[model samples]
Target chain A: MAEETKGFSKEEEEWIKAQRAREAERQKRLSRRGGDDKNAVNINSLMDIMVIMLVFLLKSYGDDPLKVVDEDLKVPRSTAQLEPVDATVVTVTRRAILVDDDEAVPIREGRVDPSQKGSGGQSSMRIIPLLDRLNDAVEQRRAEAQLLGEDFTPEATIIADQMTPHRLVLEVLYTATEAQLNQFRFAIIRSTTESVGGIAEATPEI
Target chain B: MARRSREEIGQPDDPDLAPFMNLVIILIPMLLLSVVFLEVAVINVTMPLGGSTTKDTDEPPDERLDLSIALAPNGFYITAAGYQRPPIEGCPTQGPTICLEDDSVDVAERFEEARRLLAAGQDADGESVMEEGLQAYNFRELYNMLSGFKEDFPDESTVRLAADPDIPFALTVRVMDVSRYRLTESSYDTNEAFWSAEFATETAEDGEEQFANLFGDPAFAVVQ
Candidate 1:
């Protein structure tokens, strides 16, 4: 064994043989103990952390009623305090208009496609495609409300990008109005700061 | 039977949690992906029931102030009870409308100055520039003007908000916001604490804080 240990001094070879012997002794001890000492990892602390993280994530997920997901759609910051409610969502991004996450109309250069407009093309306030989609949604919502024996209030939430042109917003509103959605809500990022300077206060006198 | 019992007693008490750990590993990433940290809220607005134009009624119009604000690309055109605001002498007019071009209340300039200070690593009046790209709308002046109107017509709550075709939707929302509330004080230390500090709020009978209203109800008008 000493001859087989090349490039190592006698003392170094002796150390290596001692290490091997210790390892073998430990292995023998493990085997005698029914091989149960295979580095049992303590994951109780890890499980506790994961459970806490899951609860937090779940809470945040359920808090928001509306999810504004488009990358091009940057919702404007405002001090409006009203909490968002579940309603028919009308999302107007820089590129397209979506009704309840379904693409209804295509927008280009901050203007609705002229062909999608009614009579006067880009000059027309009524967007034909958006009107059709909203009409369908209103009908469906009405039916659902009726089935549940509740009064149907035609409400829509408009999730528009901050850079969206007023023309596009008007067209969407007009289309929604035609579909009998009288109550319109503009979705905005809620902030308490006066940096934007629009603090909505309640007027009891009104 | 004796050997089996002995072997069972020697077994580890810890259950096999590998499957549960695997499940947690998968679930955490999926939930994290769908989680939204944004504080999203909504501003309620109503469309005129009879379209853009008001319907004719046999009864005479009440003393209620019919305030209409037209948001042009140049500036705001404010009209109340059929009286349009005439052009101010010193302020340079933007097109035909009476532009409120007060530099002291210019929101764009304040935003720019705040941004410059923040970029230079200096304090910006306790305000951090949260959003970029400010329009030239004089929101402070607008707020002051609306506050004055609220004083004159305390009972009036509705303001007709109409915007030119070229104006941005964000500007329209800003106009609605300024029209809705009256800021009692001018300055605040932090953005989060501003609402409680400056705004005129009173506690209701039920212990809820009641915000002082300016023009709380804003109706969208068609740009005809």
Candidate 2:
């Protein structure tokens, strides 16, 4: 019968030790090569440039969220012969009114009484609420200016639908004028003329 | 071989960049992915009025001129001879057999015709003609039209651009910019002999005096 033992000879042990030593030397050589490549490639500088580019792109993206609303209520056309100078714009449509193309305030069906339906079942336009909101926006702007100790000439530009009743358009205009925004601009379509200043101003009916 | 220096102990020649490269590769695409293109208003404006009033220009002796651009659904009408009430006579209708409740003449055609008329009025030839097709009024056409009007009516250049309420706002702004350009050239013209003398000689007191003296007042302005 052969005897079984968990022991190795001295020669076998020395051979195993030599194999381990060889592996360790190979590993050291590989590490040294990797270290030499680190300075040549300059990965940090490359990353710095990429990070700067990313930041630049982010800063330049001043996206306005207002244009994403119901495109069905797009602004109407006009050939008014005036240049639109620096002014804040408000757009009114059949379904809703947009403030600075950012917020859409829905036009609620006007009610005559708090609890009862309007007479003839026709709702009145909630113009007062719209006016109030506009006033609030103006006040907010004013407050911001006050905080900065700067005076700003506030001008409100109204872009209304052509199908809108004259009364409604007039009321909005009246509200804006009352709000002390004299420098108003009404958008219009392009004309044949290159210069806008030459076109005669539209006279007020009043 | 040189002995290992103690000062060089624990000094790594290369800094770790795997995390940073990972961040950059992800971030570069992320930032690029985040960019969005938008259309911003370069020129703002409003429209002018009295565009359809031809009676104001009826008196040739008054030297008043009227130009009207009538826009219908499929076509446009340009009547520059003198502003007369839109001739209600020849409204185009849908074909003989099939007439729809809302069917009417080509409003786009009328817009084109109006464009042609304006072009003709501005042209030295005074012949209104247009290229076939629904040409969206762009910046160039507006520039040509307004600049020509400015050159022709150096004294009083009033152009009435009447468009259907349904036209796009962006289109309107491009048109408005054309009108705005008219005043820019006037600065150079003020240095001309005729304008300088006219400015020097104007001292009218009454409305009639003002009317007589300001007969040549440049009236090109935008009204909506």
Candidate 3:
């Protein structure tokens, strides 16, 4: 064996030294860490909390009685307890009124134009364009319902701004009623502080 | 701060989860108790089929007292829609006194106070000073009168919440609450021990079912 080692090259001798250093380093690390990895943290309990948080967050999401499309419309606060059912949407912002993303009525500075047949300063109550579009949408929905063999109760969710005038709201209602979309849901911010028939100590959340 | 369950403080094989478990145990129940993490509710605001709907009346016109409330720039007006009775004004041009009651509660003053607080910033309960449409109207007096009106016409199912073209939709909704239900005082009625949850789950005549809608909430908004 001594003769074979003498026969070996200088590179082989250096490789053996490096291997010894690596083995020594490994032994040192194992001893320092008490024969286990110290970098790992016990995260099983944290995972439980994460799961719980996910479930809670999921439950709170998308449960609104009505889904609001326009982010501009700040719904009025209410203590109404009825949960929202899925339906066609009528979104009335401070500036414009839309039905299923279609601009059914034009509003300038929160008032319908006098030029519009059934909106603005005009007292006709029938938003002609709005009515027409809603009727078409309703008819299309009715057809879909018929195809699916579903009972179609023309359900419509009115998503209006809290600052929207009562006049505009009435106009929307009128237009909706004329279109035969009667089932209504007034979108509102959930007020956990107020209740029906209780002294509404809640300050108005605009 | 956890006591050793397995007597393995420095053991690298096991992860020390006592602290995390402790936090989660407290957090789960707290999230369960909160309303935001649970179900959200909505209100059903429906109108009659035709252009306008008259109240259900079997009595003569004189006996039928239809409650029609109009909110204008000057003040709040309560009138008999069925008949042509002159409106009873609350917060008229002269003062805050409504229906001969010596109410010192100044609607404008209260509104200013509320606005100041809001400008400075406030919590949900702190904003109670400015109820119903965010106008500086006397909600207490309004409540007192409505509650009395409820006594007068216990059978009245609908109330007309009419407003000027300028009145915002939010105020109308708040006014609806004032007309249809009674509000409770805030939990923190004092200097100490503020219980933020003071709202009562409304209970109807059925007792078990909540949402005791005081006015039956058959309200209508007149356009034009």
Candidate 4:
């Protein structure tokens, strides 16, 4: 009977010892790798990439336009930073030059100065007709400002077609400046979702 | 230590980056798609009137060159505030944009040359065949003439550009370009550049690379 009791104790101890060994192996692994799971993958690289890209996009924001582009006018695209503001607007297209919707001058080599009498004398820098019109606009603006008790600033914006000759465009600018409308802004067409070169990158077909 | 060990023994480790990572992932693509790469620059021009009827008060003390450019049907009539030299004039009635009497340009040839210049890229050689075209105006001559003016007055910063009502707007911008920079033969690559004395001040950081900064300040004025 004593032999039988000793045999049962030995068998039970052997089974308990096997279970303790498995538990100790698991604790050793947990100490080496902490309580974290083995299947976890590191994404430090992806996070770093995301942070860099976010900073780059923040610097590319831009301002909005003062008015919609005229249907007849086609403005040039440039990487200029200044924005257009509310003011008297001039639209110069291939067909005609309009100052604040008033037909200021005809297209082509049409003379702003009607006096074609002088040859070697050299034409005066000022265009009388255009100046008179601009002065009228300036005076009107001054009167309105006086009524509102606001400071009067003579300003006008020119939206010229990119294809128009520099001389014609300059004339409009020169004319405006002569009339005391010196402050100005040139309109440009800038858009997102469109490449500046007007061409999209080709996608590879798999 | 014994209490902490007992508390943390069986807990699974977890990182709380779900909110931050999710935010970054969403923000990056939204901003990238809406990004506008096109730069829009505004050139500020102060036109000095020949005589202001509005106010006749304090005059500017600085004697900066009041050099003015008048765009005529024929060409440019360049003058100054205090008339020191007779106004320089050019541009023939029938020539390239700014015609000199000696210049003989066929409009058709210039058009053909421009077309060929574009197609040369698609050609096998792909070399830029024509470096420059005969502009409607003599921009090369304009550059040379303006360079002479710069040499005469080193301190002058502004030039009053006045154009005719009939002239094209591009000619004004081109004249502005030629006035400010010495265009290289390869400068045809860049169509327009904005520079005033302010350009020199802004770009002075990089001392090695040289840039053309002529009369950087451009004032657009009209003939009174």
Candidate 5:
């Protein structure tokens, strides 16, 4: 057999050159069109999607706090959606009485102070202690209102434990009523549809 | 020419909305749910009933208005004192067939008897005994006894709650809600901490439909 030619014949060479040119042209066309879409980031669309997701996630959550009565009777949950509009709040806890941030008077369970002692072995409710604190706060608020020329009185809201003795609660109410804080509102947890008798009724006369 | 035609068609270069749509569908529901959740109110309000010691002498002594709901460690005893007459000899001791224990008569029966007596008194006048029918009891009995008052004293405005020391706070609240009032007292001294809650008025127009609104519609706290 004759030795194989190292180079192509004229016809073969022409075909090879034409094929190379065609491939180069195709490659050039592809490059001009733009490279593969690998790293392009659609930031505007991404931001839009992120914002939508953020808003949707926010909507799914309930801002209302889970009202649970803990062992420590602190921060009672209220169903009255109305904000505590009353500037003055008198919070009576098992521990003590709190009025704004002035101070707290520790109330002992089952036993009251000597000042509340009645003639009978029954001790009077220790409301005097609470009233004194409240009165002082009211007086301060009144003076402030006078200085600022604002309208203010002892219009206060009372927050007390549902279990607090009626006697004690009465004392607080009597004291408040005496202070001319007739307009009052109570904070309660709205749960099941069960009746909470007698104590919650607000009879202006009583 | 083909590329130019394709460009004129305005087809988006990329086609992927999986993440975008997924985010929108999930996010929209969550935000709506959260806002609805925020609006709900959770309140546990205990209302009060009408009964007073001081006003006993002022009102006509027709029916036994003093309802004592004695709560013992084991069970409870509801004693009605101000009725025109005692319950028709409860349980009929040694009458026809057998005898029953004094406490064996169901409190429900007692309440029925009390209702019958009030109804009979109203029939006597042939108008309405709205003014006469009144019950003053403690929590457990008060809750059970309220319907009777509602039926007989439908037009009567208030009932009193005279609770004993043994009543639990939860039970007391239940009774107050049934009576539809929060017992509060008037203070002689504004500085005084303690006061008494009493039945101050009675009227025909004031009517309470729902137990929730038993206290005032505003739901004020009462102290005695």
Candidate 6:
């Protein structure tokens, strides 16, 4: 019985032990390879989120004819339902007045600088710089229309801050009129309120 | 010989999404830069025709409403072609005509009281605040008066809106808003219409519901 239990010789026992060690090493290598595979980024879910966000952002971009991106400009809220038309934009920020994003005149203390006004100085309704820019814009539009064999419809859009004085607005409008841009549109944020027959509840009196 | 079993062939690799991921990542920031969150609309306005430009013609002159609304520092001065009435008590007149007064709220008196309180270094305490419920201009009253004019001259659509130099542009916009449309208690679900003849409901392009048109055409008039 003892001889049978110890039937394998030293060399045989050594071979068996070596075979077990080899199997363990092979298992370790397999596990290492599996861990490496796990490290590879599974970005499928991430791609899904990114694609959705991209679609949403693209839809919102460039949908409007005019974009009021200036931080200083706070357009008044109105119940007017008319959509904005494609026209020359005259922006009146707190610090300056811009025509087609070009600063035409500077404003000080919510009023146009006296030096920038035409003839009558501060009391004048005409703004020389703005009038010049508007005239050029009108002439360019006219030339473009003529080239396209279409009639020129002179129009402009006024995008003024809510706190802008009415005098400044009138001056801009008057300047545009002098430049032969008679049609005007005042840009405002569309208000969603039930008080349509009266002033909005959030409107400040003064 | 039998074809190789399915297990003998390795699974097909996933389509490379690296380029797509890069594209999406780049496009997101670019689009975000140009995205506009504010819903902007426009109020159409025109410069009032100057009196000096009246042309000589053989055609009989049409009777005009000549509706003008002047937003002065004190109050609104309204003038029309045929409408005339005595001015409110203690209200001032424009030349020979009795202009309308802002009778709804005494904004000037409220400001005076506020100034006094501030000078005395006192808090409002239980007293109503100066700006609360006290509008500088009586916009509701103005709307009512304009509605009356619309009733009288349904054909007249033009109104000359003038404003004081110091008036905020927001106030002018508010006036324009009130002048443009008259809101009724009508909804899409309601089959019945209140004052349907005057307050017709129309859906805007963006699916927003709107009320009937009032003096839809407003012209900017130079302050006299």
- Which candidate number has the best DockQ? 6
| lDDT tens per residue, model 2, A1-206 | 01221365666566556656766775687687774333545566777788788778767654432232132332333333344544556776644565666443554321122222222322332344455666777787788779989886677666654233333443455445445554555653332231222233232111
Give the poorly placed runs of model 4, Cα more than 4 Å off: A1-63, A66-71, A75-82, A96-151, A162-180, A188-206, B1-40, B51-66, B69-102, B106-141, B144-152, B162-166, B181-213, B220-224
* Candidate 5 or 2, higher TM-score: 2
Candidate 1 lDDT at B137 equals: 51
Q: Per-residue lDDT tens digits of candidate 4, residues B1-224?
A: 11333224666545578899999988888876665443444445565565322123365523445676666444456655455344234543343233432345443344344334323433212111111222433444455556666766676767777654434444455455556544343223222321111222224556665555676567764435
By summed lDDT, the worst window of 10 consecutive residues in model 5 chain B runs over B126-135
Candidate 3 displacement at residue B210 in angstroms: 3.5
Candidate numbers, best lDDT first, in rank order: 1, 6, 3, 4, 5, 2
DockQ of 3: 0.26
Model 1: pairs clashing at backbone N, Cα or C within 3 Å:
A202-B211, A203-B213
Please list the residue runs of candidate 2 whose C-alpha ends up more than 4 Å from where it truly belongs after superposition: A1-41, A62-96, A100-102, A107-130, A156-179, A184-206, B1-27, B34-39, B46-105, B108-164, B174-224
Lowest summed-lDDT stretch of 10 residues in model 2 chain B?
Answer: B211-220
lDDT of 1 by residue, A1-206 (tens): 75678988888787677667866886887678666465645678999999899888888877767866445666777778998888999999867899999999888777887898999977888899999999999999999999999999889999997667677787888889889998989998776544464344231110
Over the stretch A74-153, how does candidate 4's per-residue lDDT look in tens digits? Answer: 45443233566756777776556666678765554323334521232224444555667778878888899999999998
For candidate 3, give the docking quality class from DockQ: acceptable
Q: Of the native A-B interface contacts, what share survives in model 2?
A: 0.14
> Model 4 misses residue A26 by how many Å?
54
Candidate 3 C-alpha lDDT tens digits along A22-105: 668867876786664555455767687677785765466535334442335556666555677777888887567888878887
**lDDT accuracy of residue A203 in candidate 6:** 43
Q: lDDT by residue for model 6 over A1-206, one digit each (tens)?
A: 34643878787666566656766775687577574446666788898899889877766665666755455666767777789988888999877899988888888767888888888887888899899998888888899999999999999999997657777888888889889888899999886443322323444321
Model 3 TM-score (2 dp): 0.61
User: CA lDDT of B192 in candidate 4?
Assistant: 38
* Models, CA RMSD each: 11.0, 15.1, 10.5, 13.2, 17.4, 9.4
Model 3 lDDT at residue A113: 74
